[model samples]
Target: MLATMPAAPSDINVLILDDNQFDRVRIRRMFESLEFGFHLSEVENLDGLDQNLDNKDFDIVLIDYNLPQGDGLEALERIQKHERNCNATTVMIAGDDQSQIAVRALKSGCQDYIAKGTLSTHRLRSLVLSVIDAAQASPTNTDDLHERLELLVSRVKEHHSSALQPKVAMIIQDIRSLRARVYQPHSPLAVELAAVEKRCLNLWSSLSETDAITLKAPKDVRVS
Candidate 1:
């Protein structure tokens, strides 16, 4: 039983994959109270999840541990294959306290996790801001940044699409080294990136709010 949530004003795009109607409703209600404008799309099973990820990239992806049709961890593992969606910040939501699942998710690359019972409007909002901040923050080292840049360049060259924005396919096709851009203030993708960031900041003024054994952050990034 797969379904897509109706569209909303999109300050950020989020894709949520979970099978339970009640839990999905709860998650949606949390977003409704937030000031930020977000477009959310939900899918109940693995096929739906893969179909959505294949066509569009989400800024954040939240995955529930139990699914009617498949394991959330297994789905997370497969998401790595999506070159663009692979970089989306991911978080895991579990129905119960499961340290092993949490650890495994972290090791696999998820940025954060929380028990479903513990979720609250305030907590959800805080986590959203923090993770988005972390995603925008520059890498801790040059090599890490360089590696990302090279990866982006190569991926875009092969696919003729940007991992950052599906719409801005060739945005960074001719990107200069990030090392130079660090001192320069703007890169080729500056305009688009700035717009995305400015929206995040504005959403903060308004207020608001996945996984991947499949997608991992760089080694130096330690989520608090």
Candidate 2:
């Protein structure tokens, strides 16, 4: 099941490295929804990552910019030093605050940067398809994909400011509204959207919750 791809002649093998189990699960779910015969391998630490790269023949690698072991740059460096995986296509999954880091990776030979918050099922599939298509069409030319990914990086950099928190709040509200509409009463989309909405709501609740330490401080205590 992991090595067979019936949709295309050349099966795509993907390796994902992230420290968060929730993120790993989310990415796996998104990939499973693509309905393509792709093999996926995941690792949570640098050791596992190095071991996988050494043992498996992967076509692409998706690395989280911030990991417990080290950052995505360290992962990229390892990939570069690997004798067999040196030329493997790599993408960085970055937070909104990390556009500059992503840009640095892109300049250092990463294929693309995907903002963590923007990774929905549709976006994930589109990105994978674009990368795979580009890789196959002209293994040397990535101009189109590079231009588009640069645009995404620019957008992230543009939004990296004090206003980002409010913007995120607005986006979550929009998602909630959209989910409510799609999840009317009892439908499959509704069921799925309900789960999505719950996740968003939980995140919102966390954001809105007052800090426990703050609550216990003296009246004169300043949060700043």
User: Can you write out model 1's per-residue Cα lDDT over 101-189, one digit (the tens) per residue?
Assistant: 88889898887887887887776677667655665574658899899997785554444322223222222222323233555466646
In order, what is each prediction's RMSD in angstroms?
22.2, 23.4
Among these predictions, the greatest lDDT belongs to 2
Off by over 4 Å in 1: 1-10, 138-224
Measured by C-alpha RMSD in angstroms, how accurate is candidate 2? 23.4
Residue-by-residue lDDT tens digits, candidate 2, 57-135: 8888999988886789999989988998987888899898777987799898888888987888777666667767776
lDDT of each: 0.67, 0.74
Pairs clashing within candidate 2? 183-190
Please give the range of 10 consecutive residues that has the lowest summed lDDT in model 1.
205-214
Stretches of candidate 2 exceeding 4 Å from the true structure: 1-6, 138-224
